[model samples]
Target chain A: MSGAPATIKDIARLLGISVSTVSRALKDHPDISADTKEKVNETARRLNYRPNALALGLKSSKSNTIGVIIPEIVHFFFSSVISGIEDAAYETGYNVMVCQTNEMYERETMVAKALLDHRVDGVLVSVAKTSTKFDHLTLLQDNGIPLVFFDRVCAFIETDAVVVDDYKGAYMASEHLISVGCRNIVHLSAPENLLIGKLRKVGYCRALEDNNLQVDPYNIYLCDTSEKVEEKIGRILDRHPRPDGFFAVNDSTAIAVIQHIKKAGLKVPEDIAVVGFGDGPVATICSPTLTTIEQNGYEIGYEAMRFLLDRINKGITAIVARKKVFAPVLVKRESTARRFENR
Target chain B: MSGAPATIKDIARLLGISVSTVSRALKDHPDISADTKEKVNETARRLNYRPNALALGLKSSKSNTIGVIIPEIVHFFFSSVISGIEDAAYETGYNVMVCQTNEMYERETMVAKALLDHRVDGVLVSVAKTSTKFDHLTLLQDNGIPLVFFDRVCAFIETDAVVVDDYKGAYMASEHLISVGCRNIVHLSAPENLLIGKLRKVGYCRALEDNNLQVDPYNIYLCDTSEKVEEKIGRILDRHPRPDGFFAVNDSTAIAVIQHIKKAGLKVPEDIAVVGFGDGPVATICSPTLTTIEQNGYEIGYEAMRFLLDRINKGITAIVARKKVFAPVLVKRESTARRFENR
Candidate 1:
């Protein structure tokens, strides 16, 4: 009969044990004898026994999955963060449902709804650029779903979040440039609407004000593209009394500035010292190596998932408004060294 | 009563419409009038009418979620591929469950089982380094689950796969190095067990044979880094009669080689030219920007999903297996140029 179906009764009859004892042994219950449990497990493997997926699903209202929504996954920083999250979640027997919003509010909302409709146990979100509203997020929370935000968080929602201290990271970057004897510092910024962008700007302003340097609006160029930053840096160099230092929100833009400086027959650190946020792999490979603020994206992701699991396991009904801020450390590299040393 | 339990009947009563019309309007049936649909939709929104997740789950017996398992997420190539997958899946009303195997076979099996237990509608997989067996994957297929393999795929599994032309890409990279006047070219290889690694080595050998260069066993370095590849590269460089040209299997290792070369007081492309696979952002930002093979990771992901969707929609059970291979293009940067020119 194709190696008789190994039900609890079959196992009990074979082992001369009670059916309840056989079942407990199969489950590794504390009450079962160690030898019996081992034998049951070995026999089950030999029989090629398979558990019922539907029964498990019915017993646990949870699909054992958490949904994650991000703007994009191609960026170096975001990928590292996802690695960290995946590692943590895997350890806890949880899976992640990843969706990309493509920086569109409608798509983000649709993704959230779809995840909810899938009955995902919890959610971890990094809002899209276009997500100025949080009605979609509220819908998830209103259904008693545990939600956690990391990196790009929505300020309108009340929930746990893991974010780097962008203000301090940006401040330290600017301060490093200042310490390197650069005065006319230019801050290449992101779209000024997001909280991260705003915080970074505040940090830049504080650093300049602390150094008794005038915060010129002209010095703060707003652009999203690295190509635009390169072009903007070129134009800035052509202007009278060119900036001696630059701080960018990311390594891509900082690398572009370095390329532009070299094209202008200028030297890094010697001619224009620069610093960037997020000490990603690009920051190290850049010629002269970028002296930037290291945001521990891995840690942020790990902690975000941990916080989410905590809420999920506890059956959290109310949105617990808490912000877990990770401090950013400055990684000093060759890009922002003292003037007139190498040349 | 707080509200007369607003349903299709209540909506019809309030709008002076039939229950069928209200239901059709809610579903946005093509036959329903646009004005009626809009009015019913607005009323449903105002009344906080939401569909039952469990009821929908029962009707479709599909979660509308796809599982994605990868070896690692921190790699730039994988992340970009995931972005493409996310884009395509979101467009088709599917969410992705992301899991990482960390290159461990056991973890891969665990993740596959977990995804199946979660009842994901389908799966996209990139096999892990230690995965030589296809038992876990075969199990998914046995259970009537749709599975698609991308990047690193298994030969035994008869399923849809999306992969790059690794052999051709490696041949092109090696040929380019030869054309640039390098007689001795060394290949820095990954673990020689996997299909991609073996294919790349074959391509490298093909190029050397075409150029009438002897295939020296010493020229091929097997990199098995306990943690990092930098130390391995260092040892390779310290050997006698250092190769005039080098090709790495991936960008991370290639970047590490660049750092080591600089530390050894050698210049890139001039002292020893180098080419890397995977045209990641690191390739662009690295000193003397790396020349490498650019794989369309996003396209691979998008197409893999499309193939799986086709299978799902067509109800094709156990059809002839198919393989889709994408060609990798060459991206020339400063790292492989005959003369180092800053632009």
Candidate 2:
């Protein structure tokens, strides 16, 4: 029962006729005799033959599928973005083909090339954290396929992108801690390779400078998202007096800092205050709750997909490659509840 | 440059020949002269023409794409399942097109028809929590396309499925609470319309009955995953004497019980010990961490895909639909730490 569809060859074999004749008869060509057309149409109906859509795509070379590449789908932020993409694509009557690189550079390159080979109408990407190369992306450009980057993006290749205001979000985080009378703050940061990391660090430093507090390089410790953040924070605390405040790059890192400080016999927002970016669900679930920045993942995803579809319709040459940025909102919670006692 | 791929007509227009002549030339037919073949190939290379793989699929009728439908991807459990599905699909040279129903029955049915119209080679489904009517699933079966259900399944439909041992998992949850010297327990459960909901209730009751404890009908409380669990638990506790033990259907509900208990001036483990199913991340993040059951989401996902692939390869006639179940593991955490002093 599970065999190839009834091709012209199958019909020709059944009717003892040429393949071309069978094909022409099915299409009701005038060259085909009425008797032959009747036999072909009856047999085709009996065999439940529905002409494959792929055949039409082969002739036109348009699959109506958009390729979507992401670091991973199991993550909270990225998954929310995917939900948004799915919703937007549904409205446009487009199907989405999803590929996960698992945050590896080699896999990202391989999938990108494979997508090009598949002749996907357009591609939406959030590059892997390990990705530093742009050749694979340039290949898509060469293929004349529209490409849009959201969140984790490549600066070397110019394209339309959707991103949250990371610098302003970080500035608001630090400023909130300062408003609560905290000085001697430790800023947990990500590696400078990521644009957000650099932007967030710049915001933190600028906030401290604007408040007339000396910006200390030692206080700004660079951390990797993949490494042991709690250990890094512990080491920093062991060497320096427990800072009165902490500003982490993300809520997870901020939660880790809160856990580590608690284990070190310190109380949250009492002995030491803390703040984080990305007001994800974990922010509300954690004890003493996380005070962080909400980046609106759904909106980010919807805007990204909409931007990609627009680029596809506008054609690559006409695309102005606009970058749309949204501001992040500060969500104050129990983690940074009050002014420090000694302040 | 956003245009369709060069067709046989394009080559014919360029060379002043019939469309069939260009097609014959590209196919290297003996009737076509060497010069015509060379011209067609040269022009094709210049235009970077790619044969629509779908066109070949139309001729043979195998798209090699599997349609995957899930409730939502933002959820930790479902997202893990998708990750597993993606990894498995990649190994089998299959691409997955994902659809999210957002837990709506009407949306689920609509997506199902859409996937069928897309003519997917096969389908893998984890039905929405709200899915009760299954004509949509039956439609796939009627169409002769292979179908497999995972986790949340359609009980009325006869199809291959993968599930965890809900009965044993719930039994173990209750037994653990009993071993910790808990009596007069309350059980939080899912809507009875779901098979797992009924199975879990049976297990909980059996555990209590075997231990010579009274199985009061009033002890069972129906709860929805989307409802306010804190209010439900509070109302249950208000009218009756607080139970010495509590068993929740999932980790989130268990967490809610813990949070509510804390607000009610009761210390977890010290006052009313509790256990939950699905040892998700929230189980560890919640203070007085949840003691729960761990069903391997990735394994469930991998197994579901493997089963679906087997069905797809074997054809519709050979598929003897089966339900594969795996045992759930119990994770001990702070929520069920101390033994009752009265014991």
Candidate 3:
């Protein structure tokens, strides 16, 4: 219970060995005999000896750690990405420092500063909903710190980025609805200020145009929360000429739409087909299941870390800023069938 | 593009100022004029100067980072908990260093050692599934580093722990099922080697005893995966007299059980009532809207972090090794209903 720390000298004294011998043993020096090293290590363990990392950091200037900043960890997409990043970093003997922005711009900026303060060699970031600026991110790059962006990214920042083909995913969802004999399809949109959201909206519009369907701006409803989504869907359902199909931005909101539809005594696919983006767990667990676009969150996370590590090792002089985009795959489930079929 | 690091002297030379004045302005010294401080600050910003954190760490001996070890980030429960932890930590200017064990005991031990090597002030741990031994955790505590356990914990370690009232939650779930007039009840359990599993089972037994119902060993099944659970539930249902009620340890498994029961041409509440633990999003979105025991995962995370920070601030001199148990609430939904009224 003593506040005093145990050092190499303490272990050496306890084991009746010289300080140099104890140090060599602790460092696995070849000159030290295996038996003597083992005895010294055992004694060190017994005495609860922990080498000071601060002193080591001062000597080596490398902590072997990376910082990761994301909007929210609870989201299915980000968590999958984090899992992949952790796997890659673990293999390389690197630890990840994670921070959540909670979709706040101020929090995102704070996390960047905190990561810098912690001396992380590099950072992996997914910008928040309100993050329209890039001064903090640019500053990190300017200071020779490697930065990588995944999912939601800032277009102005010149850094390695990993993004899913949001445009293509939205286009496919809209086109699929058209292929399934739906003309009036409502696109549930998120905030329009971000790059990903704008890209997805464009994709949805292109799909409608290509299919010779009228692109009614009224059909594009901007909703963020589940309650708003339910209210919007309710209003949509009560219209004079209701939309035959719906394409939602994310799975959680898509599931909410399905729930509201069910509560109104209407069956999915029979009354209105729904396609959701992000094949999250909520999609599968929902009744009738959700037909959605499946992006490889884990691959994005893994590649982002790999790219950041490469940047860190090669230095800023060796490589130019680059962006990597992952394509989304369509997962056919019961939600968008020709007719309603209860499992 | 220069490999050489820019210093205060270089900044002062570029701005035509003294090095002492530059340093003073950077530190916001009172002697520095406002106009001169602004100029120095602007020049430093234009050059993207960052003070070395390693030097600071050496002087302070505190890394200002907390190491976090979780079983998996992909799981909804752990991810939600992490969000809470991140929210709390960021408010206190603490950054989180994260590692995933993937439920391997060896990986858990390695992460612990690595965190220690990186000089983290403390560790927040959720033990892995294969963690049967406490020797690795003991190594951390013996080194004078504080440790806090949340969710999946090691019972042998006498330290601060944050846990939900698993026993009470399970008891409530069982009692709810019995009240819905389910005479034949089965408990879908996780691995019984862990404290959580054992505590939940005890609660199930207590509920049965309180209701004057005999506990049948055959009614309890251990399931670790969806496939294993489906197979086990299939065998139980194939029996002469099938169980009319089910209580699952977690929501994912509960959803799987419900899905399997539906495949067998049975309806929830009408044929069998189901109650699941962990009132996750899946519980609400699932068909029939799962009746579940709700534990505030975010609150548990927030409180756990507060407890750890308190301990970290007080250091080893604090004698109170506190354990806080959060109560779980039962969410009544469509899955459990009056047996006599249903078809």
Candidate 4:
């Protein structure tokens, strides 16, 4: 009456009928009398009533909503992936519900359970850095919910996943530094347990060996955060015959390395060349700009969601888990643009 | 039985009772016999069945979930706000569902409707930049849902809102530039339709007036996005008696301004000084590091969620609208550190 769309309750009240009776009559239920159905239809027409999609879902068993769980929403790469997922969902006429675990195992478990309880049509996830167990994720599958993993996947889970070619990206990064005439290189790596960490390390070693340089285990450090970079970089820079090149796991880490290098009175490219993975916005914002691997996070997200929806539409049946691996592109910038005359 | 937690459906299947009967028996329904209730309780204990919070919430007419609607998810400020909201919700035994509108009016209206259909216990909002009308938000209120706004708020809404003191922050920014000996300063402003844009422009004008400098209408340009900044900055830079300082609506725009200025051969804080709002991650990563206002996005989100929970607990009594405004702090960085000796 106030210009807001009429609901079933309003239609029932107008006709002095029970809400359920109005609902039944509107649906043309066999239990309802013909006279009641006609009256309900006429009254519904008069009120311009439209059923709520979610309320309709209660009967149809479809929410038309998808859930996404990520390690951190504030991280640029993850956020970009979410943006991609949102774009795909919006186009498909679906709403998205996002939850972040803040990179905690306990929070990841809790949010996973919460998503299950909400009965979303499907779920997209990127496993947390600290998560070593998968019982919570297994439960979602046990309950027959479709799940897709992106960026960070549960290795043992049989499901669709989308990932970037971390190994190739790392190889390109290490090789780029070598091409710029750096003999000894240092790698700021992720936790060894993660697939990304292992692959990147292997790639870095392979590139060194191809160039006839021995892989020095002492040059690699388990440092991904800024604080770790600041604390450990000084020691590395002070070592006799200091490392001439630095390759980091991500953009922020690379930027931090540059800042510390500059603070220690060393010039980037001139003294210590640097390269990073994940071409986030900070890559362009940083001084001397960062040359890094371009991870197509948005495309990964869009493809993951598409895979999930395909499974959702196909219904509960055994299907082999699928994976789509996107190739990484090396974006050259000032940070590693040494020897411009050489190549 | 296989290490996964047993659900109510499992209990019903084991006892060969209807799902509804098992649910009612477990809840100690009056119509259920003592024997049935005892059987249900023992089975639940033996199976280590934990009640799903959302399932229980359905029975209690509460979802135990709060909805958040933002303009974008990848944005650093908005993501920080969301992180604050999530932190508060987790501590209070609540789940959060987030949606982003990508600054589109239609998407905002659709998502608002979807949140309503999902029956979230309450909602927290930061209206879209393109949202000129308030019908979608008003509909949420009409449906008796508790609404709280943060950062961006609708003027006509009778609800709690948390915002930063944009006017005062702008005043400080302009005054700081003047103190650094900037005679002709230009502002890269937001659209006038937004409250932040209007207040910030007024504050800039007042600062000029207070310093006995005439406010040049030509210096105030309606430019906020990076694309707009790129398209319009060249002409401004080419103007005779060029602007000696720049104040932008946000960090990204300020960073873009600085890039263009440097490209034009003007040194930061030497030939031109710059200030930005919102001390996001990019502010620190950018060259010359941005001098900007700390908007306290996390605190604003936490407080907005607190106010929303308060209203939700009060159960829909006609209450007066409340607002909390946070003071802004200016962070000094190399971008505007011209008078290092004097200060």
Indicate which candidate wins on DockQ: 3
Root mean square deviation (Cα) for candidate 2: 5.8
- iRMSD for every model: 5.9, 3.2, 2.5, 4.2
Model with the higher TM-score, candidate 1 or 3? 3
lDDT string, candidate 4, B108-219, tens digits: 9988877777667789999888889998887777666789989887777778889999899999999999988898999989877778888899999999999999999999
lDDT of 1 by residue, A120-195 (tens): 7789888887777888887787666789999887777778999999999989888888887888889888776678
Please write out the lDDT profile of model 2 over residues A84-201, one tens digit for every residue.
Answer: 9988988887778888899888988877766665567788898887888877887777677888888777788778999988899989999888988888888989767778888899
Candidate achieving higher lDDT, 1 or 4: 4
Would you list the clashing residue pairs of candidate 3?
none
Give the alpha-carbon lDDT of every model.
Answer: 0.80, 0.81, 0.84, 0.86
Model 3's DockQ score:
0.57
Q: Which stretches of candidate 3 lie over 4 Å from their true place?
A: A1-51, A339-343, B1-51, B340-343
Model 2 CA lDDT for position B216:
88
Worst 10 residues of 4 chain B by lDDT: B52-61
| Native-referenced Cα lDDT, model 3 | 0.84
The candidate 3 chain A region of ten consecutive residues with least summed lDDT is A334-343
Cα displacement (Å) at residue B316, model 2: 3.5
Q: Cα RMSD to native, each candidate?
A: 5.4, 5.8, 3.6, 3.7
Every candidate's DockQ is 0.38, 0.35, 0.57, 0.42
DockQ of 1: 0.38
